[model samples]
Target: MKLIIRWLLLACALVLLTQLDSGIQIRSFGSAMWAAFVIGLLNAFVRPLLILFTLPVTVLTMGLFLFVINALTFQMASHLLEGFQVQGFWHALLGSVLYSVCSLVIDVALERLLGPRFMPPPQ
Candidate 1:
């Protein structure tokens, strides 16, 4: 139940990102939902690994490398999923920024409205 709501929120975030003039497109609600799930999974599993592997560079760059990693991950997810397309690296970077901001806003609103019972505590 909570998972479903979170997915819905993420879908909304994707829609909002599309509206932000970012080159992130989701052809349908189903695609958006699936892409959200895939992005969540990638962020949970792959992101940490990438962060760990790039720790030295991350440190050297004063955390700027994380933004690059985030954009790359977004592009990778776009590549893996059908019906979701991000044009180029710049587009992916813009999409990543939009996605992050929109998701954060949506998550906060959902948390406040639904409370912790409907939203899992942040990991």
Candidate 2:
């Protein structure tokens, strides 16, 4: 299912991030998967509300504030999950950016490889 693929991609992204940065640590594949699921849930539910409430600041910053919001979510995930760690605000920010980029790239590659049949239905 689409959700399973997303979780796997996120876990892969986390593993890649751990390899790239010493500040980000993931203890195991299972831990990474759990962290991915939690982060996905937070991003799905909390991030939108945060963005809506911070719309003025987000606009004032020309969307830059979203990165800060992402970092906060990343930090929150780190705190809520065991065996997954983001060292500091800077690390969280960088790790979040990296994770997003990696996820996007992987998604695109997978889509191209697997074709449209595997894509989730539009909302």
lDDT of each: 0.85, 0.89
Across 46-121, the per-residue lDDT of candidate 2 in tens digits comes to 9999999999999999999999999999989999998899999999999999988987887787677666755576
lDDT of 1 by residue, 1-123 (tens): 656887898887787778875577889988888889888989999999999999999999999999999998899889999988888888888888888987877778776877776446689
| TM-score of every candidate relative to the true structure | 0.87, 0.89
- How does residue 123 of candidate 1 score in lDDT? 92
What's the lDDT for candidate 2?
0.89
Top candidate (lDDT): 2
How many residue pairs collide in each prediction?
0, 0
Report how far off residue 101 is in candidate 2 (Å): 0.2
lDDT of 2 at 98: 93
* Model 1 pairs in collision: none
